[model samples]
Target: MTQTHPTFAEKLIAWQKQHGRHNLAWQVSDPYQIWLSEIMLQQTQVVTVSEYFPRFIEKFPTVQDLANAEQDEVLALWQGLGYYSRARNLHFAAQQICHDFGGVFPENRESLQQLKGVGRSTAAAIAAFAFGKRETILDGNVKRILCRIFALDGEGKAFENQLWDFAEILLPENSSEMSAYTQGLMDLGATVCQRKPNCAICPMADICQAKQQDRIAELPRKKSVKVQEMTLYWLILRDKNRIFLQKRPQKGIWAGLYCVPCFENGADFHNYLRDKQMDFDDLHECATISHRLTHRVLEIIPYECDCKNAAFSANFNENDGIWVDLTDLPQYGLPKPLQQYLA
Candidate 1:
């Protein structure tokens, strides 16, 4: 009888057991932590996510706790992490789990996918890590690993479907191996099989088509890149020691985050001040702030205006906005650029 070589899942599991990240802050059976980590990890590097995970977990601790917290609190913790929508959805999903599922994260992938911000890949991750369910994940890291392993071409929908099929096929048979196997693929893609892979130590290097074909760099075809630029004006209105901040509407860029009064242009700011008959002095133009997002570049021009009357109040309550003392700036959830401006 001839001895058989171990399969892909076997090699990956072995590698994971020996070298993969085993003690991440969120690596546990607690669905709340898993859900938070998965949401945070999307489009974010693990190192960055690691820093935020502990602080968030320390604050929330449980799904019910997260659900009960105010949105502002959640966003405050998620301040520097871009993509504010993810934080919003995480809060919404926690409430949904509490209201709909009795505060317990659903065990199955199908049910998990129904929650806000919990898409196919994230659902699969929660299932595998939290519930020990056998599911295949096709996140960016996994996609890169699989594409290199098979030397896949094109980023079309059909190619994506093929990758999913491969992911499912490669899943291990034993349910207990699901966590290790899933994490193995993630670890490999993130560490060993990255864009510039360290093929020497990659357990799958021998079987990776891209490595064998001398096309590791080209296997995962690049997407077309386009960047758009936008411009806006902001007013840093100050009354003595307090700065006025407004909560943005909850459906667009930087939604729900605190920001200074913004307008289409400096002319709009001037017109608003004139119309309100608000007395101000020491009005001076500040430096232009350039902020870069995934696909958009924002050119923000700020006008610093000091109210002449120390007794005058914007009088905007919490429902509209607030006059935050500069000393208490850290208590509010602000967009990165705004935070930088204040800092």
Candidate 2:
């Protein structure tokens, strides 16, 4: 008998069955859980999402439950997770599903894309894992793997379209194999074909064009990013066990989350205290906090002031600010650094 080797899909499926991640919290077939996991996993590490997944599911067990809850509550549960827009979008999408889809998840990739935050790759992943639909996912991880394997270079609309075509062409033949195949791609990209890949153990090592050409490190072209710097002075006004917090604008950094009143500079912060006729001597400067976002680095200087004897202006209303009890802090969605400072 002539010896034969397994095909690419077959090898990946076999490897996934033997060595891929199988014990994740969102590995179940529930579309709600899968959709939630997919959204959370975007721009976040698996280990981080693993910790938040069960807690979020516990808080809102069903699509209807998530939709019925207040946005503040949803944001509270998603407080520690950066990218506040994802939480907002998740809430809006849950409501959309309840109203438009009758609280049922769409079974196909096309319909899943109608959700606010579900992109092409995310929709494909949800359709494949939850409904057993044969769909190709072309997320960042898959893109890196494909780029290396094909020795592809360049990044533009053309490059993206090429990747989508390759992803679709590589789909497993059987619908039953979609889940494992999709997971295999994810596993291979995340563990084996990472930024610093371990090509020795990769199933694609033998076939990768980049490895063959000694250009594995140069195949996937990286776009240069400019990280901007910002500085903000935060006022931590405390009256006994209660702290003053203001709601951030509906757009921009930390949007819709509660945070201590922040000014662009120390002068503005001092002016606010002077305008309120509050004594500046009571203020204590806390250590500066440096928080880094995807493309911005923030320097936060906190000023602690005891406002036990101070009276706010009559013009100040609930919309401007409110005093929250320290014990009830968890109920409000606060920025991670601010939350930590308060804690």
Estimate the Cα RMSD of every predicted model relative to the unseen true structure: 3.3, 3.4
Q: Which stretches of candidate 1 lie over 4 Å from their true place?
A: 1-6, 278-282, 311-320
Off by over 4 Å in 2: 1-6, 265-271, 279-282, 310-319
Candidate 2 residues 242-340, lDDT tens each? Answer: 888898898998999999898987788778887777677877989999999999999999988776564553323486699888999999999998988
lDDT of each: 0.86, 0.89
Tens-place lDDT digits, model 1, residues 127-160? 9998889899998888888778877777889888
What TM-score, to 2 decimals, does candidate 2 have?
A: 0.94
